[model samples]
Target: MYIHSTDVNRTLQSAISNLIGMYYNSTAAKPGIDYPEIPEWPHGYVPIPLHTVIRKTDFVRLLTFVLNAYELKKKNVAGKLMFPC
Candidate 1:
């Protein structure tokens, strides 16, 4: 499902938390040895595609672009980043 929300911390958190609650008992939420099962991430949580505002529609669109050194070269390119620094 294409999960959407307003591009902001509050809305994003609400969407994520809701998805977690919705799929908490499902296998999709179950951690795997290579995927969400790694020690770096939380157990029982799977990565779901959470889309926000569409590009060219709002200022948040700019912030949504993935930001990294290579992405900073191509344009910062990961969800883990917030700014281009």
Candidate 2:
């Protein structure tokens, strides 16, 4: 099965968003963790900061590459698979 780069990017974005939501919700539900409170905007309007926007894309790319490499290792346990540098 082949996956396009755009599709992978979209999936990664969704996965990151879901993970963040889960983490935040879990923290809110737990009392022992001492999670910091997130400040609320007026009328539930939250703005994306410029720094987060810049760093998130790079973070997503790094995470996706690492996951792909891990999958490759799991599939090629015989050590016969060669990846181009």
Candidate 3:
């Protein structure tokens, strides 16, 4: 599966928020250390499960693509700034 990290993170965040909301609504209890009090606001980094590990080749490819895209965007922005229309 060729999944982007940003997309995966977003989906995970949404699922976690939904699950937390469901748990709180069903039990009518405040969240503890296991869960954040505000599901919408992130407290820290979310840990990825071991089952959903990414391949080394895939990770390298993704990193290369991201870096190249960032560089291209930076150059484009700089060019536009240097030569305004």
Indicate which candidate wins on TM-score.
1
lDDT, each prediction:
0.65, 0.49, 0.50
How much is the lDDT of residue 73 in candidate 3? 68
Q: What lDDT does candidate 2 reach at residue 73? A: 81
- 1-85: candidate 1 lDDT, tens digit per residue: 8887877798899989998887665454545642455667766666679987655675555455533344556553546555444
Global lDDT for candidate 3? 0.50
Off by over 4 Å in 2: 1-57, 83-85
Candidate 2 lDDT by residue in tens digits, 1-85 = 2222323556557655654554444423533234333444223222222222344456656677778988898898798998542
Off by over 4 Å in 3: 1-7, 25-51, 55-85
Candidate ranking under lDDT, highest first, comes to 1, 3, 2
- In model 2, how large is the Cα lDDT of residue 58? 63
lDDT, model 2: 0.49
TM values, all candidates: 0.50, 0.31, 0.26
Between 2 and 3, whose lDDT is larger?
A: 3
TM-score preference between candidates 2 and 3, better one = 2
User: What digit string (tens of lDDT, one per residue) describes model 3 on residues 2-85?
Assistant: 323333566557755655454444343335543466768454323333223354545655777778777776788546543222
Better of 1 and 2 by lDDT: 1
| TM-score quality measure for candidate 3 | 0.26
